[model samples]
Target: MKKISRRDFLAASAAVGAAGVLTACGGSSSTAASTAGSAAASSAAGGKSTDYPTKGISVICPWSAGGGTDSCLRAFCEAMGKNLGVTLTVDNQTGGGGILGHQAIADANTDGYTIGMITFELATYKKLGTSELTWENYAPLCRVNTDAAAITVGAKWAADNGITDLPGFIDYCKAHPGEVQMGGSSNASVWHIAGGYLMSATGIDIQMITYQEGAATAVQNAAGGFIQGVTVSLAEARSFIESGDLICLGVMDEERNPVFPDVPTCKEQGYDITYYTQRGMAAPLGVDDAIMTRLEEACAAAIEDPDFVTFMNNNGQAISYLDAQGYADYLKQAAVDVAAAMDAVGL
Candidate 1:
């Protein structure tokens, strides 16, 4: 399959605001949800900034304990707790493909005592029809990190196919469209969308095998040769790559990930594609402005905490910071972009 020329990809990205676009079916998330915006604003209006965090606070996590999101959030919360002078408890409210926990965060009291780590999947909830939850449902505090997806395959498969690099792999896919199989984290997950992005960028056809259990299983399938490769992040595929069982062909990022300096970016290999899954903190809608400000400050301070910094570096997660307003703007644009990706995968 002929990969997309840089000019073609840039034009496509431009049509969708670089991030991409959701069809009008997902509605205009360009602005914060009116109800949430007005309610949060009115809640703060006529009120003096008050002292926050007189007691312990809880943080909701949509994923399972010990997972990437959970561990990172735990470290972050610990740092934030230090800044706020209060304990921050992480409640793993896992279920419904992160919908239940995300909804729980939005439905929490507006007292700023309850906040949560919202993830990349928040952009898909409404489009997937799983829940009405979206970034518009919460008052964003700040963006924490983003992990870029990668093209990693079993060493045996690459050797057998003579796929020495990303171009070689693309040539094989072009020669035998629909014969290649790639694994993904879950249906409609970011890894899944990465597959669609790959196909959209390269004009190739391949079967996407999805594992609902998550990326760990998909990574295993790739290593075991049950699939041709995986489109998950390098961190998720790190063990296999390290063991020489799998070789990463390319990362969908503008620059190389520091953890894996040798892995070339897709852009460097003639594809201008870049995609990542993000995580950030947010509170329920209608949180008082003063409390939101205090929480945002805690998030800013906590992101740079030495412990959190070490934890993220060691964990292979990249820190991509964005303040409250920037995060809100990003969420809106991400919703637009994700809609187009969902369309790409026939979601």
Candidate 2:
């Protein structure tokens, strides 16, 4: 796959900005897919916009380096910065299941320069009542990708225990309750959320191991016999899966992933729950209308760039684009969905 250089991506982003006015006309009602695609293509070729990126931008990622959030946003922010004629540097402020990064952006002046990725943590943290941070804390920029969970098992363990697939693994867990340990990246991270949902749906008592450590480390621990199961973003264990170090049991999604089409979804396996781990940017609350509009346009351009799409696809991301209001709507619905899920499990 050819990667679009940051410089070109920036150039294209600028062009798209110029087409923003045109987009407004079409934006009144969502256009057909073909029209939207054509508009996006023209915007890419249109030329740089005059009202963007007078300076560098700071994109705060809540997770550590090399994690799914970092990798996905790095590709996107780099492309977006190129489009906007600025540098988008990522600052890792990891802790408290993403509260640190959330707080950083929430506390920062809504100057449009300091934006950060907000994940399911945005909702999960609220349920935990850890801090006052919620979707309202930041300006919803655009969603780059949202991930459904993947059931990953250490390669060695799968072979040793003869649990080759999801059903077999579940059967084994049912046969030997409490023997199989499940490790989560964070207390309420999507990884653990899927495990909890699975436990409730399956009635399997898989021991939950809390490791607020990064996803890679969590997968390593699972593969190393510290635990037997892990649920994480596809990006987190992509390399391991390639090298046969891990086996994905089932992906916690409604549709099967094209790349991992062989893997079944939790629903396919008779589980009714579906949870997503999303990555998107939001500005601090109280951003000016002009700046917010510019930021939203820039983010939209970033999401539409062909290069960005290719990058996300290659990196195991499912494109889930939503503008500010759409993202806000998602948050509102998510609060209800998450609240219901939590109640179902009595969390």
RMSD of 1: 8.3
Q: lDDT per residue, candidate 2, 251-305, as tens digits?
A: 8677887777787887787665465677777888886666677667778888888
Cα TM-score of candidate 2: 0.82
Clashing pairs in 1: 1-174, 22-336
Q: Please identify model 1 stretches exceeding 4 Å from their true place.
A: 1-51, 65-67, 340-345
Candidate 2 regions exceeding 4 Å error are: 1-52, 267-273
Cα-based TM-score, every candidate: 0.80, 0.82
Candidate 2 minimal-lDDT segment of 10 residues:
22-31
Candidate 2 displacement at residue 57 in angstroms: 0.4
